[model samples]
Every structure is written in structure tokens, then in C-alpha cells.
Target: MDIPRSFTIRESTHRIHNPLDDAKLAVLGRALRPAPGWSVLDLACGSGEMLCTWARDHGTTGTGVDLSATFLASARARAAELGVADRVEFVHADASGHVADEPVDVAACVGATWIGDGVPGTVELLRRSLRPGGLLLIGHPFWRLDPPDQAAVEGSHATGRDDFLPLPDLLAQFGALGCDVVEMVLADQDSWDRYVAAQWLNTRRWLDENPEDELAPVLRAELTDAPVRYARYQREYLGWGVFALMDR
Candidate 1:
């Protein structure tokens, strides 16, 4: 009922699980302008940041589902800290096929589209919990520039170049799925650094504290290699964004 220990350790300090910074998330909140008291359903909502913050800032109520017990604990704490404990709920469950008991004003699956296999399947899954005319928020990656070869692709954490489409093709994908791209907030190289670089520090700190832990060697290796990998490939070739979509 939990994510891998390696993943939890690597992201222990992250409030948002994706390549989005708090400012970009705030910008997205303002752009969406979800009405006060609207309901939201967030799938694979790591740390429940979106639900907790939206409940605090927009007067929205919501439920967030994720399999990470560690992240769910953080999410519940954040809800209480934000004074939105009653407005949002965090569930420890598989998000892949989970649908809200009631339809919601906004449904999102940010950065975990693999829960539904891929973009098309994930989009359909999100729609199952959305009310008529409700918004869908999808967080996905695109190719800022085509990778030159397999090394670049692997360094960017993708198995193949086809794992991400170029920016134009990504937007076109939404249209093909019968959705209109309403609003989007993109991550620049700095945002990528903020997200990926922080993991190195988290890993190093864990390794320092628990030198004999079973995962220490793995973390040490990652800490040593991740910076070079990210700077060379991901920073240049991978672009990520959360796009607001509506039925066309």
C-alpha cells in the first residue's frame, strides 16, 4: 500500500512531486479560477499539495488519492496546517482506476499518467470523475528539443524518444482527444533544476544519516550521477507542464 522506499526517500522533502515550483502552482491556481466551494478530485496526487492548497486558497473541497503512505501523512498534515482539514481528504489507494463517488468540478492526474498507462488512457480515466463541463488538469512532459541519441533519452529518464512528443505535437494530442487546451503553466530549466536537483540533496542527507541502510549505496550512486545526467540531457531536452483542458 506504499510506494517504493527509494522513491519516498528521494522525494521526502518535496511538497509537490512534479517539476512544478510553488510559484508556478500558484499561477495555475489563479489561472483556473475555480469557483469558491467547487469540488476537485485529484488522482495520484502526491503529498496532496494541489487539493490542500486549492482548498485553502480557492475555498474548494476535494479528495486526493495516492498509494504512498508517507506522502498521505504529509498531505494530511498539510491540510491541517492550511486550516483545510475538513475540506480535503487524502486516501491511500491505487489511483489508476479510482473514480470519485461524486462527479467533481475539476479532475486531475498530474505527473502520474502511467497510472492509466498513458496520456489517452489517463485522460479518459480522469473524465470518469469529472462533472459535465468540468476542467481536467493533466501534467505531462514534452520534448523541448529532440534527443540526439539513446544516451540522451536514457539520461532524460525516458526509455525511448517516443516517450515524449515535441511541444507542438503534445498540444495537438489534446485536440485529437477532443479536448481544448485552456491554460498551461510551463516549467523552465530553473524549475527542472528545482525539482530534480533537490532529490540529490535529499538522497545525500539520507545517506549521511543512515550510512548502513540497505539503500544507501543506491542513493549514493544516484547522488553522484544524477546531477550530470540532469544538466546534460533533461535540462535541455525535457519540458514539463500542467495543462488545463476542457471538452471541445
Candidate 2:
């Protein structure tokens, strides 16, 4: 029903759980150009930043479903802070296989495609909640360059070389799935640094506040190795983006 305590602690301060910063997120929203009162369904919507911000800026209303109770609380607070509490709703539930009661103008699974097992399955899941001609947004990472070996793949936090395709192949995936690639906003190196580096700081701060906690050792190890691993592998070899798709 909820994420692990250690996971929450490590990303406690993150507003948008992925590499997209505020500016890039806003750019994606603008590219989509959802009309006022358009409905959106966001699965694994960490902190509900996308839904809340879209509700504020685009006058859309949406529902965000996530398994993390802690993140849902933060999402609700963010909605209220943005004066969009009445427009967006956050549900504390598993996002996997969850479909909206009504078809929505935009259906999204950002940065958590595992909810549907992988990119293909996740697209199927999102399609179930999308109206005809509606948009589907998927946030995912692609290999910026081919990893030299298995160790390089692992260093980029991937289990195997097949975990991600290169950028062109990833775009082709949508076409293979019967969707047209309409738009995309990619994360730059600076955004990647912000996302990964902030996690280290959050872990460090939590460790400082809870030195005796059982998870302290785990966080310590992560903080120690994360930066070097990110700088050496992911920062240069991994790229992330949110792509807009529509049924052709």
C-alpha cells in the first residue's frame, strides 16, 4: 500500500520524482495544450506535481494515483498550495492496472512504467484510460550512448543492456504500438544532476537526523556511491524525456 520507508526518505524533498525540472515540465504541458477542464489521469504520480501544476496553469482537472502515502500527502498539500486542490485529486492506491472511470483527455504514466511491467505494457494501460484522439504521455529514459559492457549498464542503474533503447528506437516504439509521436521535452544534463544529486543530499540530511536508525547504513552506502556512479555513467550515457503520443 505504500513505498518503503527508505525510498521515501531518499526522495523526501523531491517535487517531481523524475529528471524533469519545473521549466521542462511546464514546457511539456504547453506542448500538449490541454484545454480548460480537460481531464487527465496520472499513474504513479509522485507528489502530483504534474497534475497540480497542469490544473493551475492549463485549467485542467485530473486525478493522480500513487502507492506512496507519504507522497500522496505531499501531493495534496501541493494542490492546496497551488490553489488547485478542488481541481485535482490524489488517490493513495496502486497505479498498476488502475483505469479511470471515464476516458480522459490525457493519460500518463511518467517515470514509473514498471507499473505496467514495461514501456509496452504501460502504453497499453494508459490507452485504456484515454479518449479517442486523446494524448498519452510517457516519461522514460533512453541510452544516450551504448554502454561498453554489463558493468556500464549496471552503473547506469539498468539491469541489462536491453533495459533501455537508444533515443531513435524509443521513438519508433510508439509508432510500432500504433501511436504517433507528437511532441517531446527532454531532460538535459543539468536536470539529471539536479535529480540525482538532490537524492544524495536528502539521504545525507536524513542520515544526520537519524544516525541510529536501521536504514542509516543503507543510505550512507547510497550517498557514498551514487554521485560517482551518476557522474561517470548515467549523466553522460542516459537521457530522459516525456513523450506525447496519440493513437493514429
Q: Write the per-residue lDDT of candidate 2 for residues 135-158, one digit (tens) a residue.
A: 999999999999998878999999
In order of appearance, the predictions have TM-scores of: 0.99, 0.99
Q: Report how far off residue 94 is in candidate 2 (Å).
A: 0.6
Candidate 1 lDDT trough over 10 residues, lowest sum: 216-225
Residue 43 local lDDT, model 1: 94
The backbone clash count of each candidate, in order, is: 0, 0
Best-matching candidate per lDDT? 2
Predictions in order: lDDT: 0.93, 0.94
TM-score computed on alpha carbons, candidate 1: 0.99
lDDT of 2: 0.94
Clashes of 2: 0
Show the colliding residue pairs in model 1.
none
Per-residue CA lDDT of model 1 for 1-248, tens digit only, reads 88899999989999999999999999999999989999999999989998998888999999999999999999999999999999999889999899999999999999999998999999999999999999999999999998999999998899999999998899999999999999999999988889988898899889999999999988888888898888899999999999999997
Evaluate model 1: give its lDDT. 0.93
Residue 74, model 2, lDDT: 97
